[model samples]
Target: MNTPPSKDALREFLASKFAEAVEQNPDAVVLYAAERAPDPKRYVKRPTVQEVAFKRELEKMRDDQADKAAPESATSVSPAIRTNQLSLDDYPGLVLPGKHNEF
Candidate 1:
């Protein structure tokens, strides 16, 4: 990997190290990250416009679908959508042989 430390992160690290060094030995000169500035030319490449737009469009579509679904979930019933429920006696061998002992 060509990942070198960023300048701010490296500076923070050195500053902490410098503090630790002085706490341990006051006369010690532990210099680091003096010229280790982060290079924009070596920065990680950003996502392309098409990729960002596609992600945004997909998210918007999903949000619109969720919004469309939310209105149909009301508890009010108009007797048009029929629902049927069955007991265990309706289906034979649906329960395991061991599980049938408890029921």
Candidate 2:
């Protein structure tokens, strides 16, 4: 299948053609329409099999990277450890015993 020319390539072609037309007719000003004429076969390029394969490979790599970057589910850790709240047992010696007589 043939693909359309990129925006940059079309812009360059238009600019070059406009410059040429202005150079040839310095005395008269005109809106150049000749460049607007379309040739279906001129601007499109066919993708080769190797190029298509490379594109698929790149897309697959991107998907893999996205999957790897996602957050892991809570099931991977120990069931005793809740995912949200911090577990006091994990840090020993940080707690103090409650005093009954202190005001």
Candidate 3:
């Protein structure tokens, strides 16, 4: 009798099949699939003088902002609307009540 294929073997087989499918249909959408990894060495470096000037300007602006206390209006948020607006019980077409439901 033949034993079942391992999870790793199944995953690799599926990946190979997916790659073959992509090759067959070039226009097919696979948004999450990353074809290649980015090379750090190929990245362009920022100019040292420009970076220093930018840091100095940012520090000066931060110091100025710190000297003057932030207004209450800037920090305060309106409590009219709350997040995660839909409660699980209130959601329609629930497979099982008191459990998570798809949006």
Query: Which candidate number would show the highest lDDT if scored against the true structure?
Result: 1
Ranked candidates (TM-score, high to low)? 1, 2, 3
The per-residue C-alpha lDDT of model 1 at residue 6 equals 98
Ranking by lDDT: 1, 2, 3
RMSD of each: 19.2, 19.6, 32.2
Runs in model 3 with CA error above 4 Å? Answer: 30-103
Residue 7 CA displacement from its true place in model 1, Å = 42
lDDT of 2 by residue, 35-78 (tens): 67665676668899999999999999999987875645524554
What TM-score does model 3 achieve against the real structure? 0.29
Give the alpha-carbon lDDT of every model.
0.79, 0.75, 0.74
Which candidate number maximizes TM-score?
1
Off by over 4 Å in 2: 1-40, 72-103
Give Cα distance to truth, residue 102, candidate 1, Å: 5.7
Tens digits of per-residue lDDT for model 1, 1-94:
6899899999999999989988999878656767877666766779999999999999999999999878677655433443455555556669
